[model samples]
Target: MTANWTTYRELLLPGLTGRRAVESELRRAVRDGRLRPGTRLPSSRDLADQLGVARGTVTSAYTQLIGEGYLVAKRGSGTTVTAACSWPDTFERAPDPAQRWRFDLRPGLPALNAFPRDEWLQAQKVALLALSTDELGYPDPAGFPLLRAELADYLGRVRAVATRPSEVVVVNGAAEGISLMGRVLKAAGHTSVAVEEPSHFGAADMLTSHGLEVRPIPVDDKGIKVDVLSTTDCRAVLVTAAHQFPLGVVLHPERRHALLDWARAHDGVVIEDDYDAEHRYDRPAMGAMQALDPSRVIYQGSASKVLAPALRLGWLVLPPDLRDTIVERKRLDDLGTGTLHQAAFAQLLKTGGYDRHLRRTRQLYRARRDALLDELSRVLPDWTPIGVAAGLHVVVRLPAGVDDLAVQERLARRGVNAPALANYCRLPTFPGLVLGYAALTPDRLRHAVHELLEAL
Candidate 1:
């Protein structure tokens, strides 16, 4: 299909003043199938004359289009649309009407809609302007020095984590921190690590993938059974001491002492995931277990729950002995996390912006949590909510003979999303739903609870 000069020249009549504008018109024509494959175009000189534009503009457009595979120009051959150019008929896949939900109650998410964008942008601007030329070069693998120093001070003040700036290593997120720790432990001749039963399954999978046998230790209202962990042949244990995932119970004070004692007795290690300690509502914030025995415990904390998950910013306060190996592992993993983000976060901490944001979000999340509980009580009083003292989620225990997975599926069909508690466990123990209320407003949560009841 050879396009004559008159037919194609008319297509380029509008908005053909600049080289880029000419290129855009031609590109659009080719993409929309007006200039079909194998259609020869007019000479650049002829097109420029016809469109009343400079010849160089047409030539530049031709060169760009040729480079983009939209046009082919060869020596001793005229310019033509590429024979291979094909635009497929594209359509968006329609969503399943039955599966479209009005609310999402799945766990481990922050209220992203409430993120402090202006504060973060201002912080970034300040950090960049304040950065010295030497500071912008290849970043220190451990972390940005300012960020490490600020985080050291902040963690000590807020979580009672005892560590110096030299002891902290910034990584991508909590997941990468766990992976790095697993590799470090594996290299140290450790074969097995114990994890809380019905915990975040991703932790277990990461340990197994790193060639460590994962032994599950059951968790009750008091958190992981330290007695059972003592009996295991594992040399390391991963725990969410502040706020247990999916279950939400704090590690009891007695269990905390027993865990440290067991670690001391066997020369073992404890990996503490202090994921959402800052979101506590009902009581004083619990200090991290790492404060008790920094030599035997590795403390990991992330900004995912407080700030935004997209930040992928987390830090590890390592025991002095394990510091070198973990830093080496991080250096080999990704060199280091983004330097600019670390600097900005450090600014947020130093200027008290981060703390202010935390104070605001804590209150907002507490209100949402209360609303969710109230709605659940009014709609389904038989279902009991557990672990409401801290964190963004609560587990609602279903009545006898009710299947949690079945309820989850039913909720999905009725436009509500709630994950079954069994999904997080290696072995089934109870039927329940893990509901997160932080991401949605109170009205949306109320409507979702009503829908969930209808599904039930």
Candidate 2:
């Protein structure tokens, strides 16, 4: 195991002519197991001579590698690859990983390419500079106060969520917000909750893991069937009322009232996941379900669709009865979400940068959706698009008898990752596909449609 890398020196080493190149090659060799644990590297002088690089170049690379714990150097032992010298192989253009984005029409992303990097950086810089030393420490378990205030104000103004700063809870993402609610519900002796029939599978799993049964009430074009929801003995339900997930239908005004009435009669709670509320195209998204009766509804929204998901920032506007207890759970969960991101976002919201970002992305996403729909119409006229003109994805129902999963598999073989509608359901229902179009261009979407037709 103590073999000197000088052996490969005769092969790959000869091609390395700079410090970075030399470092990268060694890193790759270690990753590929060519330079395994305890494999000594050639001396800097030796490597420099072998690779036609300056001696300092090799020495600096070796020094940096030693610092990174990739190599261990000793006076007499020389530099050798460490036992723990493992890193992701960023150098490799391996097929499996690269194949993830063949067509990449998978849902749950906005126009990530439209993120305002310059504006964000400026806001972050200003916020970080103004942070007092004490402010850098652990944030409040509920959220950074200023961020909560900003979010409360923004939600009230934009989504008509009737919440004050005290009601706001920052979460890593909408996923965590759901998990927190699941814990709260389970602890309150709630044995079951309901979700939309073809709702987010992962959210249901979270509830199930927390010892709650997740009942799925079927939805129609107008939204969740409140009559079915009332029949269920569950005391709580999660709904995507602004624009239903997978289906893309907004809750009809009458249905919304009926759903709220059922909640009141059953003494139940409503978890309104206002996902993709920021990207409405044809018309303004309806005001949040939380506003009509904040006492009965727990509203959740996230920056994932409007901004990048990498930000991992989401908010919950909770009713007073649930706020304190969930805040306690959040304290136990991760102490608190990071303050730096919260403060930076607060600055963005305060300065109107967030609204500016949404405005730009709204236009961009609308165009992308149009492009996708236009292509699909031309290529597959028989397929019908469902849902409102909003969000990052569109669900198109295929003609009767065409198995969506089989079509999905065929598309996979050709490098597309779009999901069949059936994949999100607990009960079998539709034969369709959910295609995310925000990440691709007009031309690329047209091309993807061609590929989809071929797969068909």
Candidate 3:
């Protein structure tokens, strides 16, 4: 079957077109079923050579087809036909046929390649050298005293959260924070939690897994609607106030006030997930919502976005009353986050190394994001990349009736790793793909954009 491509091409030569010839050939291939859905196309160099055309011409042809939803590309894999239109509906079902893509653009991740391995190792070595014998024994259930103090100071300065050593509970990461909070909140007689529509599905799912009724609150360009929130009888609302996941809209000052007011009036608590607030590329960064009303907001921040997710380091600033309950839950759960890593992180913070690392990565990510936007502009004229101000991803909204999920499945079959935005939403809405750019190089980005357009 693979050899048939060249064997058939010899009998039917494909003419080269400096302009519209490529587009015409693409249309012909799709019509004739020569390039069926989920069919992996050859690389630009290979295709260009096979068709006896320049590589730029191949790129142009693929770009045109991608816009029209004919092909797709993924990281580490070349192009392929969109499986939705060409194969069975289950074509390109996610988390399957692993290694199908050549490029991955899914959101909510930092570039693991850029982790500060040397600096972290140095900090760990220093901490270990200075450690007392007693430090290695059974750790404090709350957290390492040094890490808690460091987080207390750091959150105070950057996030303006009313954090203190005693009130800060360290978990393995934000996931644990959610679980701990859910456990405590459930124990306190809260059975329902209101979440943002199109919110972090992972978080919302976690809430549901804990047997709490999950209600969806609508989100506008500003942030989650505060008026609709008052209608619900929920005991808590989980919010990504600083940089809302997927959408990347910062909760405005007025909305923040509204949220705080709602929390105070309803005797409700706000679980703030400050997920990627540190990697701001737009205006000056905003502080945590807990700053406005500490008692009503349980502030959660993690090193996942800035450093890496594998660190499993996160802190929760709890109200004075719920502090003991959350800590006890943490103790019963994972015992506690490791002492040495906490100590090393503390040293990284105090010595100014972590801040410097963040500054460097922020600059690199900003450059990569610019490259992705620029490529989108050049390759995709009609399509606009939304939510470009901050975060690792940009949303490309296709015109109405585009079926972004279908287009995404098609792209995946073609070897591109872009996921549809519809996957995140619990309710039906617009069709778009979330394109993450932090981990890709400029050359890789250009190739991905070209392949994406071809797959579409």
Candidate 4:
């Protein structure tokens, strides 16, 4: 007779075998709450058959578990999890409720669904095959040599970032890179750092958390107000120069020179967060501010937007004087990022695969951005879309007296997740929503925009 059995395929490990493994699996399941109290376990014979083990092994495991108070067995009844046992906390954090949305328009997220998996896998294989025992040992705190070299070349060619391989330090991501820079700046006795007014909220938080005083510098259609920044005594400033966040304005040519001049005159530093500079649609390419003065600027870039955030791979092109300290800081933080992944990324870059992937994805994103704008024009004609020329998201400015947070909450109830502009600002100034388009298809983008309009 066919017996009813719940699948326990995930519990099986290749190295483990026999009754001991079975007992361990059962114990873990009960302790972890995967098998709740009074939950019925499959019969020993059925479990044994499914696991390709002897029924005696399953029976022995069940007997041991029952004796240990994890399970109970009775005549004419099956083995079941016990109710009285307690387990130590594993300390796993709960998942974010915001991630449960059916349609998410949160800004700064790329098209994760379109990641080049097969190409990455092949590159990984090639990297692994080429690695020696020495290469697999402790990694360089700066980064993989090959990746640094390739990145130096690529950055120079693509973004006009002036740097050598030795100046590049591989970081976990832009977030970590910023934190490290903050710490280094604090250690150097810098007390205050100026940040753009409506900049990335996370960037401000990271700076604050690192014990630096955050000074907000207002941004306009021309980007960060350098004239106002010159008036402040902040020793350092963080900026998104290529494509300003939320407002989507490129740093004006005069402002770029003025920022560098301000840094040079005050001996201050510019932490250029080169976020989403690659996804430009309407504008000609802009060279990095670091290229103008590498000594006074810390240029940060990440694979998150172009490739995938899950990779957590980023790079910082530091000035020569700051390189040693930052490398030391990286050594203390996780002893450098994963070696294998770095090697694979280097291989991807070396093979020109990275460039090819970017070309394809950029075209797709441009199309998606166009669809989002077209739909917005039709459905929400009154809402002005800002920063639409580049990046994965656009900022939609609302009419006067419209509460963006209220609209966000209302959209959340309908399974659409969009962030309010006020959340990114220190003071309430702009009333809008930051809507991402790259993650969703054109059809879905149109439908989501329609739904948003209807909800409004």
Candidate 5:
């Protein structure tokens, strides 16, 4: 028999912060067995509306139970209460909802709901049936050769990147590719790398994590200032030429040419993270920066944004000179990606399923992006939204003197989740919100946006 899942609205309230009135009420709900194991809790959205408190409050309450072993998350399943979790006996300030707000507007994530599960499962079935006993053993350190060959054809058709399979190294993802390149470049006597100011904090963290000096060059409406690049004594620069993260501006043509020219002159390498060029809405897609200077750029692409981050699959089309070093580095890093998963992904790509998925998701994201913008115009007419032409997020610049962190906290009180742009920037800049629309449905997005307006 299937276990009957229970709803603990009352049991959850004693755990809530705002009501001194309901401490006993929540205890009663729990003691009466109203809440049961394997019962999925109401989503932050549903509970927020029910409790008349912010979603953050509900997130905090659930999180408290989860941390105490009251809840467990099963991948491909929902979060559920566990028999082992202990309900707290006393009250404290509501757990910080900032960390748990579910309708997160944070940038650089894809809509996980739209992943083509049926197609991928079908492809996996075919790959499994065709596989031999030998193929089930350890994967090639360079990756499945068929996968690499398919990547070569796919990249060429989509990105205009001219590369042979031999020049490509399959790393776990773009982060791995970047780390590998950092190591390879450092070995070749390049210790200093240049990054755009307000550049990807993740990339900067990676370089800094590897003991590399990252010089930050300012970015303008035209993209990263090449004039600053001319002055830096750096050996490599990581640029998001197709669509910059957070800011969402494409690298300017002049800057692209300048970067290529500079790399040629200084024997530098440009690492291009072209993670989502497939989702462009406002203009024609940009070609790979590596296309202009194949010898000087190491292009990195990933399935995280288009498919799902959990896939942990990405590829690097390196310059011929860096090929062997990058491969050697990847060999040391977990050997390679999962053979079963890679084989399944390869079959999906070869059968055109992946492309169709991207095409469908692209339209879905575009609609969501437009919906977010419409909500922004309605709710934040005075605030300026930057980087609306592409990508999963839109940047909403707050009204002058409006404290972003305070606004974020207030919104937390309203059960909506958004991160301040200040959190993403190293140097102080204008206060804003980086809102991701891909993962949210249209109705939920509108409600979240409404909460954001109420917070402001």
Candidate 6:
């Protein structure tokens, strides 16, 4: 997840007081290795304003740190923690998780390098200027009306999600959306919820946390087994119908109808996690299952896959009857997502900037995916790539008798981090690795695949 500069500011600002205090904090941070080498200090003027100190005080602290060999400042480059600062041996410090790998092919990460910073900043500027004083106040716990409206319309057009502004309740991200669903469903007499057998482990943990038994229903090439689901007593099921996670399959059209029929017959609900609603390569991705039965499907969408996850933006298009309860749950959850972000995203949506971003990233991701597939065929001809060519990742089936877990370990030793497919499953499944291609260039992806070949 990406933290905005403002988030970093909030995290670093509290309890900072005088020049000495600032110096003390910086020294402690650097000494403990929390402030790792090469970390740039905030500008002196910005630090002064944020901390209510004189600009010269910040400059003094910088000078003191520099003189002591803790920091270095060049003419063009800002002040940075110097290599002279000792890496704390006694402290349990670590680098960013991705830094551990030479190539990060783990599933579900978007291309952070390709994030549209300029366009987002422009949207934020528009939002900030347009927001009325009243709009800046505590928002309706459900969401900002403008954002809800924008999300409703955007989802309708892009994913064919059936919704209205009143039905959309903005949450922090899909994680929170799932948590809210778990809480609400469990409270409303739902004892168990069915999830795809090979599904997001974090979501299962969330459901378990809320006292709901998460049943792992088997998924086939056609998607989740609705026939099997019909026999179960679970009243709600979470699905990635648009582009099934990890596997990247779309829910088959007949099965889609059958699942909704099951919902109608059994008084069940579907939590449609449209995690990768767009980003399809070969063709237009299927519309969300939420469109088939709005009363039964709770649609979940987020910017995590399209934008940087650090943005922490997601929404739920709720059933009319469930809207009030979910919105009330959101009220108690965090009063609502931050208004500034919501407003900025609204501006992005309203101005068509979001669509432009999608168009650009779709092409980039498609090219990267092509490079990976082509390399796999050339170098590892025996490996089978499964599912549609429509997501950030592709699952490659290993030759029979190969242990994917062992392969993953070997890849880890080689500084690559492709996840074993079996780890995502509750039941036994085929041996394979889930490779994410979005974050890496075509050349890097090819290099990673060669490394995989070596590991094999």
lDDT of 1 by residue, 195-243 (tens): 9988887788788889999999999999999999988898899999888
Model 5 per-residue lDDT tens digits across residues 1-456: 132212444445524544222323433444355656555655554666666665444444543344334444443354565554344556322333333454666677788778888998898899888788998987777788888999999999998998998887777888888888777777788878888767666777778778789888777777888888989899789888887767778888989999888888987888888978888887788789888878988889999989988888999998877787777777777777678888898899899998899889878988988888788788779878887377788888888888675566555444455766755565768888778889888887888887886665
| Alpha carbon deviation, residue 170, candidate 4 (Å) | 0.5
Candidate 2 lDDT by residue in tens digits, 262-364 = 9899889999999898888999789999999999999999999888889999999999999999999999989999999899999999999999998888888
> lDDT of all predictions, in order shown?
0.84, 0.85, 0.78, 0.83, 0.74, 0.84
Candidate 4, lDDT over the whole model: 0.83
- Give the winner by TM-score: 1 or 2: 2
Candidate 2, residue 298: Cα displacement in angstroms equals 0.1
Regions of candidate 2 where Cα sits further than 4 Å from its true position: 1-99
For model 4, name the residue pairs that clash: none
Error of 4 at 97 (Å): 9.0
TM-score to true structure, per model = 0.78, 0.79, 0.79, 0.80, 0.78, 0.80
RMSD of each: 17.0, 14.2, 11.9, 14.7, 10.6, 13.4
- Model 3 lDDT per residue over 339-388, tens place: 99888998999898889998998898888888887888898876767653
Residue pairs in clash, model 6: 2-310
Scanning candidate 1 in windows of ten residues, the lowest lDDT window is 91-100
How many steric clashes between backbone atoms does each model show? 0, 0, 22, 0, 3, 1
Instruction: Evaluate residue 227 in candidate 1 and report its C-alpha lDDT on the 0 to 100 scale.
Output: 91
lDDT of 1: 0.84
Candidate 4, poorest ten consecutive residues by summed lDDT: 91-100
The residue ranges of model 4 lying beyond 4 angstroms of the native Cα positions read 1-89, 92-99
Candidate 1 colliding pairs: none
What ranges in model 6 sit over 4 Å off? 1-94
lDDT tens per residue, model 6, 1-456: 122334335545475666667877777778877777878777666667777766545665765566455766654566678765675546534455554567888788999878889989998998999999988888899988999999999999988988899999999999999999999999999999999989877798899889999899988899999988887899899899877877877889999999999889888899999888788999988888888889999999899999989999999999999999999988988888899999999999999888998999999999999999999999999999999988899999999998786676556546677878866777878898999999999999999989999887
What lDDT does model 5 reach? Answer: 0.74
